[model samples]
Target chain A: MLLLSACGAREVVVQGNFPKPLMDPLPLTLGVIYTDEFAQHEIFDEAAGRAESDWLVKTGDAQVEFWNTLLNGMFQEVVQIKDSQTLEAYKNTVDAVIIPAVADLQYTIPLHTNIKIYEIWMKYRFKMVSLEDVHGNENGDLSIKPDQYFADWTLTAYGKTPTAFLQSDEEAVNLAAVVALRDAGANFATSFSRVPDIAAWMAEGLQPPPAEATDIQRLEND
Target chain B: MIRVIQGKLIAGLVLAMSILQGCVNATVDEMTFLEPTEGIGDASVVIIGRRHAPDYETEFDFIECIGDHIRRGDNSISVLHELDFINMMYPWFEPRTAPLRTDDIEKLLSQERVANRFEELKLEYMIWIDGSTIETNSSGSMTCGVGPGGAGCFGFGTWGNAADYEATIWDFTDEIEVGRISANTSGQSYMPAVVVPIPIIAPVQGTACDSLGDQLLKYLSAKM
Candidate 1:
């Protein structure tokens, strides 16, 4: 007889603690995005689509909420530097036409992980644009390009020797993703530093200095 | 007395070899479904759905079950067809009404006609699979080495439209089924495998495909 588990057999678990997202990029400005043939393909499957259009009237609303959460988790941090002015000015500068040209993060390559070993991988892409054009600046040239962005994650800890299992393999993997996400953010900061609005906005929204801590304890501690 | 003891020992050895031998042990566990259901939209059209398949090794135990079932005078094909979608032919082939129909004459899942080698063998029934446990283990780009477990590089993965598409296609509640699944696996490559510990409950009312070539072969093959 094939042995079945009464409670259901668990083949794998969260072997690694996924890194907690540092923070939400604030003063959020949604990117309108660029168009590409393959990259712009529909994101929904047949069954999911049918459940909305034909069967349920409110399906579209639920569907919209779902992707929003995914997109929300993608961009976790926006640190501000004192060099940037007010949040509104930073937001306007960040929303300037060029922001949409880059893909918003769908997922980040967590730190210290070799993406190759993963059974599941995630990635995203976008149409790049320039800020000078958003406000229709005289210097705007309407530069355009497809920016394909990718990050990798690995899920291992299966079939390792019993001795290997004795260690906390799962935590190791989770920590790796956290570090990797930070690395990817740093990468974005390095590349987009040229865009003053992007640089200024990113500084203000991504990471607040210890002095600017919003925690309730900070006020009491001081 | 010694000779009798030797006979008993030989019988036990034969039984052990038959019962104990089985497939390899490789388990995949875990699935991360990324997303927000919100913006997940329906595509304008669907040309085809894609799913991967498991390989022979991990499913070796099922094959052994087939072997035992056959040894027990079971004329049944005893197939562990591709997961979730089992379709086999014996009496006559009721292939799908599609451009890419399976011609018994062809030994392939593609076009161009030719007889399959197994034409002589009795094919009782095949399990049309919708779900599967197979995955490719090789890494690197598929061009060089193995692709994703879900991708077909090492042929180690299992994901077939058999589960979703076929489940709807072969509406079990309204349609007829011969037997209920006894034991199995379900879920992602890692956590997906499920086992129904109890004996399979045969369907109360079901339709058994009657075929001349396949049923006859099933009979003859079992005898052998």
Candidate 2:
């Protein structure tokens, strides 16, 4: 019974120190909402065989920490709101609102291979709602409806143990999770502005005045 | 009779020690693209491991071993810890975001923040190590059993391991790949048991690390 019970369960609480990204912040205020489910996310996978163990991985704290550090570095101002309702309350105070959720997570173990490697894959769903209008407004305030989102995208990240030195399954999973989180942070930081909608939004802000308006100003000066 | 038994015990001890120290063969090769001109006076260098490969990753310990070897001899160059450099550079040096080519690095340095950090670190070279040690083959097995009379393990097993790694040196000052070094090591490990199992492990990865490290030391210090 003891021998059989040896493969009962493996639990891991992922933790790591996430560094602030070293990039110029975008000139926009962002309101972020971390849902309760996102802040306390965990995944459980049942054991498939007598030799395989069940895994319960808790990645809540690390997720919040990583995204917080990344967003703080990527934007000029970040406002952490309680939920969507709070975001609605602060709609006029911020340029955009972003909500992030874990879409899915998958893992692989060495039981299927000769190499002692552990890998983790994560998919994240992000909803970005632009409160400001793409075109200039009379009062320079472009508040859109709270429920409308300009961009909803998914990002995937992957991580694996670099070496076979780690023996414990829990430790391996934690390390893999941390690596995946770091990869996600890197991907988001480098590619956030490149997302088509975000790019168009930013470009709109930089657009030159209309040619007719320029000619009218020139005529007035003459 | 007593002397004979003592002699036999001494022989057994000698045989066990010999078996414990496994056999490993390692080779290192270097290719210099452009010779280094300036000395490393006050500048530092960072050794990073490539982890972007889908199948394998360069071990962190191996990179650290190479760093330790480089710093061992006289007039050692300044070496930065891989994690420290990665953390300081943040997303830029991550596995997904790291520059894969010399021109990519130049473009990264064009950024004001990256440029500032590079200048602050006084980084002159960046050595990116890529590869891994893997067990190539395994054969034979042993069985262990316990009985009322006694417990015994009887089996013979053997396995083969190989370590292959390559290091590419990028001269940040010149914004070019200056040199490359590669190491390949392989060995066979054995386990033969009668009543008690004895394992003889071949240190292939360690041998590869040492060989690669020595060559990097010689190559980098030669510039100074």
Candidate 3:
């Protein structure tokens, strides 16, 4: 209800408080921003000796493929960060005005797998810092909520290592970005339109994919 | 007619599976082991030996060696999992202790091949690997002989250092562990092939650690 009211207020202001709310779509200022994947990334056990020579290319393709399967058309396109400066630009934009959510918020996970090795625990919330300029920040903010975004990583093998499991931390981050885009777009649309897919937009808020029920989880330290 | 062909194929597969049931089946038990807040050194870490693949027999030399070393020294030093499982009544090929206690067979059998580890030695919780480690056929340190490391495992030492073997452990955790280890053959170093003609390459020598068990007990004793 509160979000709906806020949406109503914002929509009114965007359209001069008139009511039709059919504003034209704007250009992307910051470009889609992703963190931690600044350099080469790996979603496999280094011990397995997987090559990263062409990792970014393969991963980018794989990520687009997964989102296309899960939520089509939610993004105009998926973009990767070219350099730290761009990332900084995106970050500045986000920090200047948009208050990203606290990912550090704790999540109490309950499980039935009786395995004591995996104790039920909580995760500290983490907040996303945008890596865009002020305009870029507006582009991301005007489009999506970072918290609702989902990312995923696919594993090369099924086993003990956290990356050994099916989806990896990097992949999870990518999934989050896609979901964020979906939510951001939905928020923008709902301000003017009354489409029902808002529920679908919200569904991406699911917890990090659990380690393969086969016992594979990441951050062994946590 | 097509249905009949499909049925025939299905029946053939079932018949073949009956003959090859052993090959067709594997029971997979899922596990989740979260790291303790405490780092490796503070606690006596227990790394349950995972069963690789195909090898039905259990190997005990490594565990025995660790236990002996842990027992011989510091209280903060002594390790609980070792040759205390050895059966003294009968002496055989390995000269070390038995891989597992015969009395514990029913307990062990009830569970699919598993390395149930009490990670922190903390009585409150335990952790088990939900991943697989490759089996090897080489050895290093004091008990340097070459054979199946475990089911599908290839014993390491035939070529690399203990750090090399760490690769197997790392493969199970995505760089969750980042330190390195180096050790020498411990307790009574004997030339691997003194009289035998085929020489081992890495010289199962002592510049590394002390005795095999003591060295392993000391080193592996502190991993994340």
Cα misplacement distance, residue A146 of candidate 2 (Å): 8.3
Ranked by TM-score from best down, the candidates are 2, 1, 3
What digit string (tens of lDDT, one per residue) describes model 1 on residues B55-99? 111122223333334334433333323321111221112111111
Ranking by DockQ: 2, 1, 3
Chain B TM-score of every predicted model: 0.23, 0.85, 0.28
Leading candidate by DockQ? 2
lDDT string, candidate 3, A101-150, tens digits: 11211111012222211111111121222332212232332222333222
Scored against the true structure, residue B84 in model 3 reaches a CA lDDT of 21
Which runs in model 3 stand beyond 4 Å of their true positions? Answer: A1-222, B1-42, B55-58, B82-120, B123-175, B178-224
Clashing pairs in 2: none
Compose the digit string of candidate 2's lDDT tens values, residues B64-115: 9888878875255899999999999999988899999998987897778989
RMSD of each: 23.6, 8.5, 25.8
Output the number of the lDDT-best candidate: 2
Write the residue-wise lDDT of candidate 1 on A125-166 in tens digits: 322233222221133221222221111122111111111223
lDDT of candidate 2 over A102-217, digit per residue (tens): 99999877774665678889999887755332222244322233334566789999889843553677778788999999999998988888998778767888332222211111
The 10 consecutive residues of candidate 1 chain B with the worst lDDT sum are B203-212
Ranking by lDDT: 2, 3, 1
User: Rounded to one decimal, what is candidate 2's iRMSD?
Assistant: 1.0
List, in the given order, the native-contact fraction of each candidate.
Answer: 0.00, 0.88, 0.00
- lDDT for every model? 0.26, 0.81, 0.27
